[model samples]
Target: MTALIEIHNLSFSYTGAAPHDVFSQVSFSVAPGGVFCLLGPNGTGKSTLLKCVSNVLQGWHGAIRLDGRDISRMKPADVAMGIGYVPQNQNSAFPFLVRDIVVMGRAPHLAVFASPSTRDREIARAAMETVGILSLADRPCTTLSGGEWQLALIARALSQEPQVMILDEPTSHLDLGNQVRILRVVKSLAGTGMGIIMATHVPDHAFIVATEVAIMNRGGLSRKGAPETVITESNMRDAYGIDVKVLHVAGGVERKACFPSL
Candidate 1:
């Protein structure tokens, strides 16, 4: 199967008085229906890398292809139609209702200055339903809690119906129940043939949701493979600077969980 997203020799750095490289020579690919999880500490360029892939960041030294088409050369609308991005931090200047916020994701499919039609709204509502936030559809986004806002953003991305979804710290600010819910949604989406690339601090999430996991640090990926092969005690220590025990599930689930040694 063709890759949904492919990165070749990707590198990025902010240009200013002091140019700092975020990551260098990073390469990866997400096949259709695959969930690729990125595990790293803060400021390790996981978000930056995701942005590059989503065509939200430019001036990077690499090629990111979406379904074999170079994203840099694709039009903004084309890229938007191909990649749906859910950022870590979400903010809105206006107090739009949750449903309206989600409907904005259909912007790429609409003509300039066109309002979202009934069909667009229906898609948005379905997306909200998928994220279990349809009840909040009438609520003002500014009135929601952080976790609720995150879910709204995710619903917005889902409404886009893009081929690939890029999520940066998708479970941030979520409660335990919501976290598990979102992970389950991620896995379910992958099952439907939508490629997912997610950056998350939770290693256990990778084991739960990712088809492939990569530990990124020091400007590149240090380890990448199946969760059992990549998320080891030493790898966690190297990436997170903490000691953790990687344990298997007691049942025949073939899953691993990590806990602090302390």
Candidate 2:
């Protein structure tokens, strides 16, 4: 597997915030055709690291290279062309149509002051089709449920044709069914040779879809390996402050299931 993104010694610190820096000297690489899961408690630097990889926040301490290009020196538009970033929340003012919102994702490729061409629209349409949201193309964004909104956001990112996608809690605020739906979509995307890095609170998501898992601990990524190895009892307790029984559910194949150790 080719490395799509390389993060070396990545570190960040909010100006004048307590503890100074959130995490430091964190390093990892994301390979194509794989899903890398970042799991940890809130504020442990998972979301911040995603933002750094997506180029949403700058001035970090290390280097992030996307397909061998040094991302720290790249312009925002250049980064946008290669990496699609889906933040935790979004708001729309006028209830834009789903297709229109997806088309906006082509901004990185479009010339300044130029509108989306027919080809751009075609790409957006294809992206919607890829995510199984073509039926909602004409629907108002405001009318969609939480699950639909999340899928729409993913469709927008897909429209970017990014080599790698960085998502911050894609399943957050979603119902159980929606969460499973989104995870299935993620697994399908990885199957198609795209590198995916998703920050998730649900360790089960990683256990299910991630080829590799990284658990943020004590201000950096302390555990990294196969999901089965990383999502262990001790790691879960350390990262989440909860005891979970990692169980195997016998079915079509062996699948690991986690539950609170109550």
Name the candidate that leads on lDDT. 1
lDDT of 1 at 159: 83
Q: What is the overall TM-score of model 2 with all chains considered together?
A: 0.95
Candidate 2 Cα deviation (angstroms), residue 68: 0.8
Q: Runs in model 1 with CA error above 4 Å? A: 16-20, 252-254
The C-alpha lDDT values of all candidates are 0.89, 0.88
Task: Kindly list the per-residue Cα lDDT of model 2 for residues 1-262, writing each as its tens digit.
Answer: 6699999988788762334378888899999887999998877988888988898887787889999999978888899988998778867889999999999899999889999999999999999998889999999998998889898999899888998988889999999999998998889888888899999988888988899999887789999999999988888888777889988888775889788876
Poorest stretch of ten by lDDT in candidate 1: 14-23
Per-residue alpha-carbon lDDT of candidate 1 for residues 16-88, written as tens digits (9 for 90 to 100) = 1124378888899999899999999998889988988888888888789999999888999889998999998
